[model samples]
Target: MNFIRRLRVPRLNDKGKWVVCVTGGVLTCGFAYALEHTADASDFVVHPFQLPWSHGGLIDSLDMASVRRGYEVYKQVCAACHSMQYIRYRHFVNNFMSEDEAKAEAAESEVDFIDDKGVPAKRPGLLNDFLPSPYPNKKAAEAANNGAEPPDLSLMGWARDDGDNYVFHLLTGYGFDPPEGVLCEEGKAYNPYFPNGSVLAMPQQLFDEGIEYKDGTPATMSQQAKDVVTYLRWACEQWHDKRKQYAIKVYFGNFQFRTPPSFFLTQIMKKWSDFSFFLNYTLLPHGIQSVKKDYLF
Candidate 1:
């Protein structure tokens, strides 16, 4: 009780020491936050939306139906510009489609091949063929699209932060006119969702009813965005579902191996106790300093 009273009334000389400690702590925190906030953070604007496959950071794996729809979206719309250079038709066969269906899909396209006579010839795409690029080479691709090289999208979903969301927004967020003072070039389209608001070379891709959905799904802007993003996600990581399953098993296995039932019960309690003591030791002085600042100020 006496000690509590004494603490409530610190010696007058100690007040300056308390103020110095509190001021130093606040200045340290402020400096840390300032250091963390950087110019690149401006480019990280993400428009929030919900999707059927992901909810609140819990990804339910890519739905096969959505993947199929997204593939169609890519074929009909995105394939004209971007290429899925790393993907093969065989992936579809292994994951989503039957062998016959994959063959049929591949057959619709053609690939360049060397004939027995050592002459170049084009042949119908095969199950093992890479998804063909829109142009034969970088210069040709650039020439067709006003000197801009559309990125290969096989790994696009994994390439950027929130890549799924970024693709969706960039695809669908184009029709609006630029805000005042924003100048869109003559050929380029304005998309606020794009990192450069007015200078993106790729024009708007998704429009209402732009492509007929074979599955009878409505081809609205948002629907197309969802389907195409789903496809890109799958294209980028075909093993996403398998990876999750593997991860789950690995997590449990590690836990079991690390913690024999009898030892875990004892260790976890001690771990928590140590953690709590460390946390209080680290925070309690700062917390007291904060209260002193509030009261004294």
Candidate 2:
């Protein structure tokens, strides 16, 4: 009778073990299914690209003429509200124009500073003086704008994925919506490219009669947008050159057979041919297949 009881107890324990295993398996499968479905759903949702130079977008090449026009607009109109602090008077002479032109332009503006020799010198250019801060700081600027401070225009061109186009649209795209409940603040307006579909700070700042251009280009909204975009682009290009030079050098040196001696030309050609074949046959198709399956799953 004791032996029978022990056998019955063992059977009971085995059944319990089986039950626990089944339950754990079911829970694990359910969790995995939920996670997979969530991941799949995310692929359908499009997130806006945030980088300055996102892939697969149209970008205009740098145009010196447009940039010159932009400098004029910035000097005449935007200079009052915005400041290009990172740029220097010497930069204009070195990078954009002749020294004589730079000097003449500098003479037209007022900038005073103390020299290293403890002597006060007044430079006749905007670059000599730091553009006065629009507000004490970010907090103050935000307070003035009803909690939305206008961003600095220094790198504004490269801050968005569509760079120049984004600047252009932001400058020109201002209007009202018919749904009267739209909460556009007193000085704010609507912009389509912006995620909020409304901007809180900038109203139509540019108009045909707002400023006079020496080039006789009509001071239309489009022209102003183009000018400002060009200026911002130039600023970004300047910054990018400083930061990306090393990476660019490495890329060209490694890939273009620029590093190896002349005797290795044949070997380099062979290596390139092998790499091309591998890329075309194995890598490219495999990548396409993986991407397709990932989306499908």
Candidate 3:
């Protein structure tokens, strides 16, 4: 009762009421106009959502099996257009495949170079040779793909926010048709998860049983996407597994460091910790076939 008495409500006389009515009308109109012109984020384009780390972390290393499988997928499917020019055949040696195996893999692809005679010649790829692109040049790539050059995959994993999730979703997000009022161009395919746009030149690539896995892992679309994303991430940051291992050692090892504790230890430890944290993003518990996959549609 005392609190209510402390509040003084102003009374509106005839003139005051008229002024109030006008003010309210103006405010209502302004609010309506603002709302009418306001941009809607969710309504415009769907953003990439983070996916949980399914593999073990902390003690466990990067899933080499997944990386190998992803390499296979890239070789058989994505290599048709996409390139990994920054990667070398030797990168596979001691990382996933054996030296002989890497050499054999390198031997499969041919590399072009100029010989001492100054004549342009081609030879079988070597361990030191960089990975090949499908096109001889950007112009050729563009011409082949209707002026859209297929991007190199070497650095794509680190190029965007939530890149792993982005790539994964993009590979799997092609099933949905464009929503009403959305005009997808004839050549471009509709993918809601595409950044800032609903349509992309890249069409649906991964499909069920598209490639057989040597390890007997079923080649579901989601699984292929997951594997390829893993490989891409490894290509982007080859030190990921080693970085985690060293961090664990620095954190729990007996040796004492002279440098400040938090700066080095804390920062490195965060990347490959017990789980969740990475190159610095907290992954939520979104499973393989979770709400995120269907959220945009």
Clashes of each: 0, 1, 0
lDDT string for model 3 (103-156, tens) is: 999999888889999999989989999988898899999887767898899999
Provide the TM-score for each candidate, comma-separated.
0.71, 0.56, 0.71
Please state the error at residue 197 of candidate 1 in Å.
Answer: 4.2
Q: Write the per-residue lDDT of candidate 2 for residues 14-44, one digit (tens) a residue.
A: 8898998999999999999999977754432
- CA deviation > 4 Å runs, candidate 1: 1-59, 256-297
What are the lDDT figures for the candidates, one per model?
0.80, 0.64, 0.83
Candidate 2, after superposition: displacement of residue 115 in Å?
9.5
- List per-candidate RMSD values in Å: 15.6, 14.7, 18.9
Off by over 4 Å in 2: 1-61, 111-147, 178-181, 239-297
The TM-score between candidate 3 and the true structure equals: 0.71
Candidate 2 TM-score over all chains jointly: 0.56
Report lDDT (Cα) of residue 223, candidate 2. 79
